[model samples]
Target: MDHLQCKVFFGLVICLWTAKISQAYQTVENDLTDENSLASSYFFYQRPEYPRDCQEVQDHCSYTNTSGLYLIKPDGYPEPFEVYCENRQDSAGWTVIQRREEGIVYFDRNWTEYKLGFGFLATEFWLGNDKISCLTNQKKYELRIDITNSYGMSFYAIYNMFRISDEVSKYNLASLGEYSGNADTHITWCKINTGYENCTCQKSCENPHECLDTCDDEDICICPEDYYLMERLCVPRKQCGCHMFEGILIPEGGVHADSDCSRLAICRNGQLRWDETYECGNNEVCEIRNNIRQCYCKPGSIGDGADCITATDCSDLYDAGFTESGVYNIKPTSWLEEAFEVYCNMSDGGGWTVFQRRIDGSVDFYQNWTTYEIGFGSADHEMWLGNKKLYHLTKQKRYTLRVDLVNREGSPYYAKFNHFRIGNKDSKYQLLQLGDYSGTADTQSTPNGYALTYHLNQAFSLWDEDNDAGSSNCAEGNHSAWWYKNCDNSDLNSDYHAAWGSDASIEWYYLPGSNYNILYTEMSLRPF
Candidate 1:
């Protein structure tokens, strides 16, 4: 005991036997973080003689910190067991041990092992036991633990075991101790902070759209009706004007009235002004009627009080009267007077004819014939009054040629009687080319007379009376009546003499005035 005090007395008895084995492993890890003998062995192994019946709870008990464990018990109440810890660096750790009769157990840290047995360990058991054999049958048991440390620092745990009733009510070896880096076995009941994860403590939100949920205890940010908090984001409430127009919104200082109130527009901030004292009067023309903003008149004009005048007149045919029966009602004052003058006091003799038209589709008949010579030049041939040769148009009789055209010149050439002939006065005959009158109202009065041998010799060869028998070549022959004007009366060989074909030459002092001529026309010949 004297060699340096015998090596300092065995190094103080090996440092007091290593401090009494580190105070007996810190008093058995502080009795597994004491909870009063694990809550009285979990209510003494789940009282009611527990054979797993919490009414057999099921509904796949919920848990999800990223899908880890679930052990249903919906209404019988077990649903609160979820523990996940993944702070990051390749974090890996998990453990779950359910066990009603005896089913579920999984452990991992890559030491992977899983089991789920029931009623007699349903085919598998030992999940690397930390303390297995618990529920001898008085059911109820649950344990979920997840610890992540490979520098990913994390931890979580949950344990409940309200039943097990058998083998000495197992599982209290200080509740199967294992967590080491103790800050008193640190648990702090989970807390993550930012988007929450078991956070029973730290929470804060500045303006994730004006508080989308996190900061409470009055840290404020509850904005939902028409929103409003700017910097912290909840926005949505600045209307001021709204102005749309075609899709019609127009709101702000709103005015819009106009269907006679002339037009008063408004809509300020979104811009759409128009009231200059309710406009539209210098001949008026704004438009857009029923849905507002209107003025009126501007279509050939005519509205007077608020201004608009120009509609000149021209629209009277007495509503188009003479409805059928050789239809005749002629009136030509002046929508430019196309051709006039017709006095056919004829039972067979009272003439005076003028009727003209020519913009190329020729039509004329200046036949004074007996009222003393006014027929010498532009009447190439359409004249067949009646009684002259005793109603002489016969391919076996059927005639009703009524012409009551008024004021129609060249706008599609009018005034009928295009070509006519009836033999026996001339002989070779054959020049029946009939009328193809022009538009703006015409009535051939066809009760049945338009069928003269199906239009004899099919119209338009005018006069081939045996090739002009006594030839004045009838004005350049080959069937030429010189396009009417002074009457090229085709002599059907000797005595029929009917004429038509005049596009110009009726100058007995050029009898008509109006610019394009042909103002009124009326010719009638009947023979049914």
Candidate 2:
């Protein structure tokens, strides 16, 4: 061949070789991205695609028997989806994307795929369609196409995806249908520093500072073995660092002074005191109770101690603010009913929802057919006579029984309980499912096959808020009294006042008392 003719031939060969290497890398990348997206559908922001490959047709992860594609993602998502070829038939062959009954499936002539991106980490190009074509006979053709990559992906080496994406995005949708290829989707080639890439990737690494892992302070040491980086250096495991209880947990990044080494503490993702600990304002102790440490009421300083453990607890529960009718109708439901359905009214003279004791000293919650007392874990509820938790009840031999709360632990502090039927230990089945909750005394086993030894009240601990180191302004709180060298009543009382122990504080407020026969308005632990 002449000099020019030989050069032309070499160029074509290099082009073909380059295409194969790009295709392979893309195949693997698409697989991983697809996998991550399948794993996270709800929390992530998935991009749009005209996916025609098996990757797009269905949600395999969600189905009983289907899973497809896995793609490795970068720290984040890609700015744009790189489109490789102008639309073209895979040299030759076919592919199809379809929905059969409940699922979407794909039949392809070539092996094509899509990838997904995560919100965190490096940005990856996410969401794409793999239009593949198999050539039983060697051939290639042009096709039209559109594609986007919202999931950002990273390769151990540089520009792996930047170059690979070019070969991956191309297909003639007009001609391709699922599983219509004559040849299986297999493209082959190799090497990252080849000619086709034209070294577009070289510019990327020119600035070392541009690398994702690059940090301003190389002097800062890497976190030691088990320890991880916080602001910088390695650190030991932190203890549970909760600052509030009876509310949702406030996360603690690491262990700090003033926290007790209570409960099993594990440092997750460098968070030493995460999902645990209760912190007190100024001077307070994070007390551990029932395997959980919550903010206790400081000596004399009291909070209902109902929700001192969770962030959810700190929030106020306004009346549905009105009636089921929609406005201005605040009411409470009766607790421990014996034979009547009494309700507390917010409009009543006495704000308290008082219960009317029956002639038999019984509150008929179910019309006297049964008598019950209730119990509670927290003080955030529509308290019957100022009490939500009922400890005792008087029920005649065999009568209809029903506790009147819709959900167990109707409030944050209450224990969760639905009526249980008595059962025999050996039987391993509910002997009676509380038909009207009127089952016979179970001599065989406990109600839930659990030893029927402790009552609901006795099963849990009593680290009331009155014994903590100190208190904060939040009302009805439990904490310690450190200001007082000793746990003295006088000092405790004084501290309570300092923390706003009187009514009007958000933590505790006692409404004026009036005598009335309403059954549902008081705030305590009982369900309304």
- Cα lDDT tens digits, model 2, 318-434, are 232222111111122222232212233323211122222111112212211011123211122222221121211111112122221111112211111223222222222111322
RMSD of each: 31.2, 26.0
Candidate 1, residue 484: the lDDT equals 24
Segments in model 1 whose C-alpha atoms lie over 4 Å from true places: 1-255, 270-276, 285-290, 300-528
Q: Assess candidate 1 and give its lDDT.
A: 0.29
Off by over 4 Å in 2: 1-82, 85-286, 289-352, 355-360, 363-528
- TM-score, every prediction: 0.17, 0.20
Which 10-residue window of candidate 1 scores lowest in summed lDDT? Answer: 6-15
lDDT of 2 at 21: 10
Q: How high is the CA lDDT of each candidate model?
A: 0.29, 0.22
